[model samples]
Target: MSRAEELKQQLKPGQVYRREDLTPYSNAVDRHLAQLVTEGVLDKIAQGMYYYPKQSVFGVIPPEDEVLVRSFLKDDRFLLTSPNSYNALRVGTTQLYNKRVVYNHKRHGEVDLNGKKFFFCKTPYFPKKATPEFLLVDLVNHLDSLAEDREMVLKNVIVKAKSMDSNKLKYAVRAYGHTKTKKLLDPVLVQMKSKAHVH
Candidate 1:
């Protein structure tokens, strides 16, 4: 196969690639990339970023948020979430938000990737995956940004906190909570611990 053909052959569907990643496959990487994009072999999602479109019965599946962010940041250590996920806690959060939040060690502020917006938060700590307890702590951390009734949400949060594993929730509070969140949740967790001991 020609150098350009070999370059195209290296692409796999449902994957995102940085320009540097494909450079080794072709000497004339830019010309090859431009041709591939024009031929619909790839989509230029952003500068220096390309995605090989994956097809399904539903048409082309957009690059996954995980893949997109992972490539954009060039770092795999990121937690992608949004306020919309808070609704799963059933703590009176019903609003659906379009915002996608990324917690990572690098990149802070909003960025656009493939026509979607991601707000990158550089945090010192974030679990590889979010646990329910972690989400509770995060909810309180970002309460000010939420559109729901704050007082009502707090009331429900306290009640929900009671039903969760006291030890796990307490650790989450200490590790992930803001000063105010930690203060609000500590007393409740202590009460639960004491009550459990009493029984």
Candidate 2:
């Protein structure tokens, strides 16, 4: 089988392939990949990742960013939480405000790639198990790039929280535990309840 054919068979959306994965194939693989690029059969998203261009049609076609996020995960036991989660929640929307993508790397500091920023905020007490609500909050905080829109975000968050089942909410709250996030989220929850009562 040819390199192009092999790549086609192995390709999956959201998956990254490295050069080493193609090592045993053939020397002409690079040439074939380049040809694929020319033909628009694949996109060289970053240094080593490639993906079908069609995947980007749904929204912002950030193939390179996705590749980098996946690559970062490969090196550390990290969660694509925060900004990525926010990105997921707002999929298909162009109004998102993710200036620099954030990740909970289970460490500290930040790293920049291809003119984009990635913040790796270290936390010593991240939950061992994540809940849907906690996940949602992490996403909201990460995507809430502006400090001024806290009220709007909190309102949206309350609506989202109410939509969830009580058991799930309990589990989510527990999973998230008591932290600074609650103070930020509490008013939103209260406002949502108040609105519901008024109606």
Best by lDDT: 1
Colliding residue pairs in candidate 2: none
RMSD of each: 1.2, 7.6
Encode model 2's per-residue lDDT on 1-199: one tens digit a residue.
Answer: 7767776666665555565565565567787677777877776655655565436557535555656665654554444444334434332222444554334545456665445666666554444444566666664444345443566655666667777654555545545544656665666566656766799
Per-residue error (Å), model 2, residue 70:
4.6
- Distance from true location, Cα of 105 in model 1, Å: 1.4
The runs of at least 3 residues in candidate 1 whose Cα sits more than 4 Å from the true structure, single-residue gaps closed, are none
In order, the Cα lDDT scores of the candidates are: 0.93, 0.56
Q: Mark the 10 consecutive residues where model 2 has the least summed lDDT.
A: 85-94
lDDT per residue as tens, model 1, 118-178: 9999999888998999999999999998999999999999999999999889888988899
Most accurate candidate by TM-score: 1
